[model samples]
Target: MKHFIQQVLYALIASMLLLTACTKSTPIGSELIDQDQVELKFRDDFKIIAKSINVDSVKTYGPQENEQLNSYLCGRYEDPVFGKVEASIFTQLALEGAMLPDFITKEGTVILDSVILSLVYDSTKVYGDELALPQKISIHTMFEALDRADTYYSNQSFGYSPNPIGEKTFFPRVRDSL
Candidate 1:
């Protein structure tokens, strides 16, 4: 019957498709290359001649032509190409909101317990070896105030108290969360 022939044809096509779908085929061009015969080698040593140069003072405060920096660098490391490099940071501390009237009124009665500081690390911009010795960081109160109108530079120096108000020494954890 015509109906029986149509059903048979449908079954035949379905079985054919099922057979192809269940079958696993090898990757294309995988048989063309032999893994044992292929060898990979690299050279790590090379004659590199370089010299360190004095760089000009970098803008450390405010915005440069409407551009502002999101982060700053502070550390000492030895580079293979640039040799030894050291960096320091200078920033102004500020309080949030317009003012605290309650704290101002009870300033003398308020007892100071402790002060805390938090810093976020930029892992992607890390330089030098992470396995190197731990770095020491000290925070001191500046003798002079940083003016927003004045442009600060990397070569610029500021006077601070000889004693450190806070200090911390830790290893650089670039990949891990600090």
Candidate 2:
């Protein structure tokens, strides 16, 4: 019986080695194909409209009318033809759910470590030479709670501290990967 078990184990190991050796090492499309011989067809269908109109006055539009339009940050840009344009963003943070399982409570007084705010910029939406120019961003804390029932607009104003909580000066870098 001992000899039979040893023979079976050896046969199984040999089979596994043979299967692994037979497997392909490289992917199916590793070889390059000639692009000149391949004929690719492409088509683009779009329309562009250009019109000149006087823009003396403008009104603010709220989220109630257009639910899709919303901004959480504001920026200012100056163009040679368009002059100076200013924008502001307001946001509120909320807790998603209950405390995590690993959350621990200390017996004595607990001290705060540090608070961090991270902002991610969308590369595709960026305009102008952001790489060459450095931007100074100021973050202010809100004085009052934001109203969930009321619709917010770009031109609307909210109560916030006159002094900023923190400020940072940095150049924008496009993120390529996660």
The global C-alpha lDDT for each of the candidates, from Candidate 1 onward, is 0.77, 0.66
The CA lDDT at 127 in model 2 is 73
Query: TM per model?
Result: 0.59, 0.50
Which prediction has the highest lDDT against the true structure?
A: 1
Candidate 2 residue spans exceeding 4 A from truth: 1-73, 97-114, 176-178
What TM-score does candidate 1 get on C-alpha atoms? Answer: 0.59
The reply for model 1, stretches above 4 Å from the true place, is 1-50, 63-65, 80-82, 97-113, 175-178
Deviation in Å, model 2, residue 20 alpha carbon: 71
